[model samples]
Target chain A: MSNTTHPDTSRSSDESAHAEVTVPRSPELEVEQEAALRLWVILSRAHAAIASHAHADVARSGLTLAEFAILEVLYHRGPMLLGEVQRRILVSSGGITFLVDRLTAKGLVERRNCDKDRRARYAALTPPGEALVAELFPAHADAITQAMRGLAADDQQVVAEMLRSLGLHAAAKPLP
Target chain B: MSNTTHPDTSRSSDESAHAEVTVPRSPELEVEQEAALRLWVILSRAHAAIASHAHADVARSGLTLAEFAILEVLYHRGPMLLGEVQRRILVSSGGITFLVDRLTAKGLVERRNCDKDRRARYAALTPPGEALVAELFPAHADAITQAMRGLAADDQQVVAEMLRSLGLHAAAKPLP
Candidate 1:
């Protein structure tokens, strides 16, 4: 799994090594490649299936997925920097400004200037927004629970731990 | 995991049951809800991270992610119906017609009438397309392997099995 394992074929860790002539097409290499490829396809399917259910629930609240995500983060964590909200959302429907603008226009969210840092700004839910999410959050959580009910509780725990490790590793940049 | 367990709060099998006055929000319910939500965030991060690596490799071959997906399917599974291609890919970039049109324009793929049914069209790789994929498939596989190197080989196998169960379960319709 390390660069040292394929030092000859893979010259750079950040870049995919091209078709090297001396690359040993070992049976083990083939198995690993297929395993990884299959894992991705399976992962994508699971994400899409669960997301469809989650999105349906969000839509009923008249909020786009990204908008609900913003409110949810604020709902749980209190006021947050706009940049932080963007980072928390895996898929930003549009730029943070555009999404925040739409929310502000809807009167569900308002922006505040940072007293300590002139350049920093925060997004906080309006009272109406707070009440709305408070009313809706439990049901929203219920929607996700239903969506994932396919897995046994023990299975859910295992998948959660496995994914956390996988995500942290994938997010790290290769040593330059 | 069955409807019989929460018949009060959740009424319909397919829909999220709203708050029922008599429903008990057991500590187990709270634990399950939080577990599912955390799993989703972790899953998305893992997907986005691994995809970025896979995508960078596809980009190097001068193909958009969806376009490469189509080519890869044909490359691995042979000529398949356009609709089948669309279904196989969890995320389609655009309408199947539009993607096929783009690939057809590049002369990497060609459409042929299905001998069995005049209404059915098959997308087969042209000589250049086949040649291109043949050249790149190995390295592309290597890219995925590298991206997944975060997990031990055994962990990848475990994840793949877990996702298969989760995806199949999610895809099944809830009995009305």
Candidate 2:
């Protein structure tokens, strides 16, 4: 994707033409902004790759990425209702339904009617599902580590904490 | 999404075994990891919202997001051929052809025979296309800024820079 064009053209080529609105940055801020932009670009590509990789790995065991995520949560935290899994995975109701359908078909997960709320269904990992996670977690952990390979161990920890804090804050916001 | 359950499963109503695995936090690196995860989550949501917003804006002008990006590039950097645009947008040949077809149908972009390479076709923005960008940019910018509110200016810059750097590195990787 290299744009081997005139320097000026390539430098300002991505966005549309408009007067540059100055969100003035201090020296420290400027450095950070450049880093942040780079990270955004990296994260997009990295995310795509990670999703593809995770999907491929999970598909072999007859699960979709989101379904595997649900299974992973269940494997780590025991049984969870469909709605609870949906909230944690940040998928819509319809999406959760579809995901659960696939997982149920694969026999990796089963839905049991809740005692307290008949409308709710609890999804628990089957024996095979638990086995799969046990086998896959090591590889998945490796992939996560690989994704963070560029950063120092300390920096990676910092990144994780900051990102978790940010995610909690954002999740707390009332969606418009 | 909270898993509030009794410690002893024998006494609890729910039968399934629960195995919650919250990572132990290290004083030195926990914050960084939090930051990293939170950043990814924020970006994911922001990107989803931005995609929707941009889609609506571009649809009004009768173009797909990819085509709009092409036009934006052409408007800012003058005319460029299909291959150059594909490179810049980082899409496959088939994807670019489809995008060009959609843009051409809208009269926002045109393909001209490249003088330098007979086999190549140039994709350039028409005057209407250029004008459309000029009209839409400000509104798009405002929407983006709004979505990114509450992040301090310094944090924004830092995050942007980090993301961009990461993105560039990821983009540079060879496709598997």
Candidate 3:
């Protein structure tokens, strides 16, 4: 949105002199920088669009996005360690604990001690939870399908692969 | 992750009979549903990875992500209305107001009354804000570049195009 060229504009005379000798202009790096910035904007906008619609769908089912995500994961994966659920849902440990507590009170989820590991617990769906997911999963899937309908199947596949690559790459690296 | 197949496992026999007549099994729809779910997972994971790293970078610069976003937009586009800023950043009206207040208190942003429209106000960056962004933007750019380095230039371009299309499509649709 800003037309100003960056890292080059508004430099003091002294800094300019220092930069001239130290910062060698690499056209390739500049191109990469611009590309990365554009990519981030597009990626963020697209994610917001899809998430907003999916969130609305989940809300209509009388569940928060986190609630829906937890139920959906448990519905598909069966019972999982509390830690595993937290990781898969990308929620904070304390946030997951709170959500699990709420779900437990609603009779939608249950926590059970692990058989082999006495200290560990697993979060499992209740009969009601399974029923809710079975009822709502179709609509959730439909919302996603509608959001992505603009892309052809092949395009969706390509986008998914590229995103997976980017996600894995970023996840593997520590923040600098 | 749950390995359980859903909607089919927990149904009563009578409900199954009812579903058999009501819910037609279409292979085409099944494929679409699977693709959509996969895409949502991939998209969310990629967003989380990039946002986590970007948020960390912004934090080191002593700005919250929302604050940085507002400053960046103002830095690029010059002054903008409070509502426009809210739309661009996907923040609530109250959230944007609070952020602007914080920025104003920090002497980085100012609100000016529009001459033509007395009811309208613009939020513009101060010289200090400009200088901070000028100094910090390069690192922000670098952080984005590093996160996206996994994808080749061509791959990045393709992904950007696809995401743009998806975002536009989703944005155009009314929430169902």
Candidate 4:
């Protein structure tokens, strides 16, 4: 692929500060880079191990991972605007729309007009969706608990808090 | 979508202990399950956020994430068996074979027979692959370091070690 062009290079100040990224850097910076990569690799492996079990458990319910994720959000948190669901699930608007539509076709989810806004819509799990999640969630939770049995409960707590902080900060900004 | 059967139920002792997973349980068990779920959600979010930035950086080089991952493995660690590469990258044997073939076609990688085993083959980077990775790796590293700027360097170190332990333990056993 001819990827010599960098769209960001023509962009404004936010990216230009990182113009030095393409070139060589100081030893300290290299160390930081290597450390970050190592951390990411470890994080990826841990997540992969845990997610495999979680996904398999969800798959037993005949639901895709994203589908189960949407259901779980509604089952626990109650009905919410489609936008809110999208945000919570970290999916694009179109992606959420497509999934909700599919779940709706499966008679698992429904969309309702929002009272607060004429243009907004809410996604709620139908009785079938609720029942399915209710049936499947416990097993899913157990699978996660078992997958995460790698760390002690106390250590899981610590890592949970750390990941919370890291995720919040990560969402707040990127590569700056 | 018709996922009514439980294949594991008809199987051995390894899965029977978890038969109770489908039924309701004590509050303590529920709490543990909830804690694990929370940890997993937080981990997913953190990884997604960081990976978004890293993926975008890699995309600028016109290489799919898997392809770049393979090249990086060979670039940093030198030649290795295909099976080892698959394990390190967490891809299936077929998936690694496809990526290696693609990289080889691109003139970035090659395979040679391993002397130790008649059936084993080693994947190594060609000069072009080495030059490409050497050019892109620093930027990729910088991008990672930047994406991970959410945590202090010291905390990154701590999380790295924690994830290392967690990953090792998680890989040791699927579930108990």
Candidate 5:
């Protein structure tokens, strides 16, 4: 993804033809802007690299990334409302429905009606689903560990804190 | 999107039925695994939060994310070989062709034959494209800075370093 946080101020070969319109920024803001842009690029590249490898691992196990995510959530959280599952995994409602249908057809997941709310439905793993996730979870964890093996413990800790801050900040509503 | 690095070692509410098969990992390895898993989740969430906002900003400017990316690359890199553009932006060759064609249709980007390689093509911005990016880029940069405004300067610097390390490490070939 193009991290649009910094204007490309570096001298381009076509510099003569391309003119700048914005007034000059203070040197401090310029440095900060450049840093923001660089950080965005690194963050994006790392996420893509790690995600591609992890997705490939899940794909090799005969499950799509979505399926693996749903199963993993069910495995860890026990039974959950379809809506809750959708929110937690960040899948769309339509996507969750489609995946749940496939999982249901595969006999790995079953739906249960909510006692109090007619419109609410819960999804629980079937015996096969439970067994599959139980079998698969370790290897999945190993893949993650292997993907991140390059970073040492201290670096991982620092990354976790930084990312938590960034994620929460970005996820919040933009300042008015 | 599922950061599958950590096994849910937490006692499940339905623990009796769900039993583990994998051998217990060492305490140190388990801690490391959890940290890796946590980092992956944070990284993904942060990227999603930031990218969604950035994409939306671009969308509001009457361009798709891919279109904006192509324009940004051309603006920064001057004329680039079609293949190089595809590689740099992580777009597939077919997708790049389609985007370049659309850009050409829109009169924002133009194609040129490679002087050295007859079969090769290049994509460069037209005067309008140049003017549009120059007009659009500062707001885009502001959006990025705003998206990441939660972190202080020191925190941003630390994040940049940590993310650089993580991105470089994750992007390298997996350890044997």
Candidate 6:
């Protein structure tokens, strides 16, 4: 495999003042890399574990992850128009419509025309939708807490601090 | 959504003992939870980013991530049979066979019937497969390194460590 480092790397440590602290190379960098790789493998496997459980949860609730996520926003914020939900969730406009349609078909969400804007439609959770969230949110949160069981509070805090930098950097920037 | 903290009983801290350290109650506990949530969000986004890039990479090179992973394993370790690859990658028998078929179709990998075991098929990286890895491994590594930019080395190490623990605990285990 080609291992040549690219020059146009946007992640150049020089550009980001925080780079040096984030990626300190030890004298035996090889050991660190190996550890990092093993960690990555484990993380990937953990992801698969969560995904398997998540799939089952969704199945039990009749909501896919995308659908559940969309519903989650609505559940928190009351009702919002399709474009707004799409914007907040960073999903495509068309995909949001399809998701709303499916949720509506399942009697969980309803779409109503915006009073001010004829062209706009808002999606709101129905009674059943609210019920679904009520039934699922606790279990879902419990699943999260369960997944996080082995981590001590301090370790969790430290890991959180470290990952914040990585996360913020990799986050999807809003459309300029 | 309901936000109930069950004081009487909940397995929220069930696996903490496995960790080398335990954290006492403090303000950082909240930060820890937020950080953990943020990390999950970022990791999910990163997985999507990798998969999306993999889609493009595979389309251009006629290799799926599964196939590429297999070829990569074979590329480094020489030829190996189907079952071996399946075990190493933790993919199902049908999944590996399907991936092998795709790689074979692209002529980047080939299968050789094992002499000792008639039912076993050995798969190896073709010249094109080696060339694909040579061309793509650096960019792949860069994508990961870039995704992790902006964090402190100590933070990175902490993240790696926590993720390892989380990964291991979350992995498939025998029923209690």
Tens digit of per-residue lDDT, candidate 3, span B1-176: 11111111222234231243237768888777767778888888887788777788888978887888888877766788988887777777788889999999999999999898988789999999988877887788889889998898778988989998998898788888
Of models 3 and 5, which has the larger lDDT? Answer: 3
**For all the predictions, what are the DockQ values?**
0.25, 0.18, 0.34, 0.22, 0.42, 0.15
TM-scores, one per candidate:
0.83, 0.70, 0.86, 0.82, 0.86, 0.69
**lDDT (0-100) at residue A99 of candidate 6?**
82
Choose 1 or 5, whichever is better by TM-score: 5
**Candidate 6 positional error at B98, Å:** 1.8
How high a TM-score does candidate 3 get? 0.86
Stretches of candidate 2 exceeding 4 Å from the true structure: A1-46, A49-63, A160-176, B1-64, B172-176
lDDT (tens digit, per residue) of candidate 3 on A59-134: 7977777888889878776788998878777788787888899999999999999999998899999999988988
Candidate order by TM-score, decreasing, is 3, 5, 1, 4, 2, 6
lDDT of 6 at A141: 44
Q: How big is the RMSD of model 6?
A: 10.9
Q: Write the per-residue lDDT of candidate 1 for residues A69-153, one digit (tens) a residue.
A: 7777776667878877777765443467787899899999999999988887899999888878878877887877887887877
Q: What is the TM-score of chain B alone in each candidate?
A: 0.81, 0.70, 0.84, 0.82, 0.82, 0.63
Q: What is the DockQ of candidate 3?
A: 0.34
Q: lDDT per prediction?
A: 0.70, 0.55, 0.77, 0.72, 0.74, 0.57
CAPRI band of model 3? Answer: acceptable
| Displacement of the residue B103 alpha carbon in candidate 6, Å | 1.0
List where candidate 6 sits over 4 angstroms from the true fold: A1-42, A87-93, A115-120, A172-176, B1-39, B49-62, B87-92, B115-119, B152-154, B173-176
Indicate the worst ten consecutive residues by lDDT in candidate 6 chain B: B1-10
Tens-place lDDT per residue, model 4, A14-67, is 432223444556878766766677778877777767666766778776887788
**What TM-score would you report for chain A in candidate 5?**
0.84
- Write model 2 residue lDDT over B1-176, tens digit each, in one string: 21111011111234435434345556444444433433334444444433344455556756665666677668767788888777766567888898889888887888899887899998888888777877864454443334334455456555444544444443444332
Candidate 6 docking category? incorrect
Poorly placed runs, candidate 3 (over 4 Å):
A1-24, B1-24
Poorest stretch of ten by lDDT in candidate 1 chain A: A1-10
Candidate 5 structure quality by residue, lDDT tens digits, B1-176: 21122112333345533554368769998888877877777777777777766776787888876788778878877898998777666666788898899999999999999889999999999999988988887788777778887687668878878776776676675532
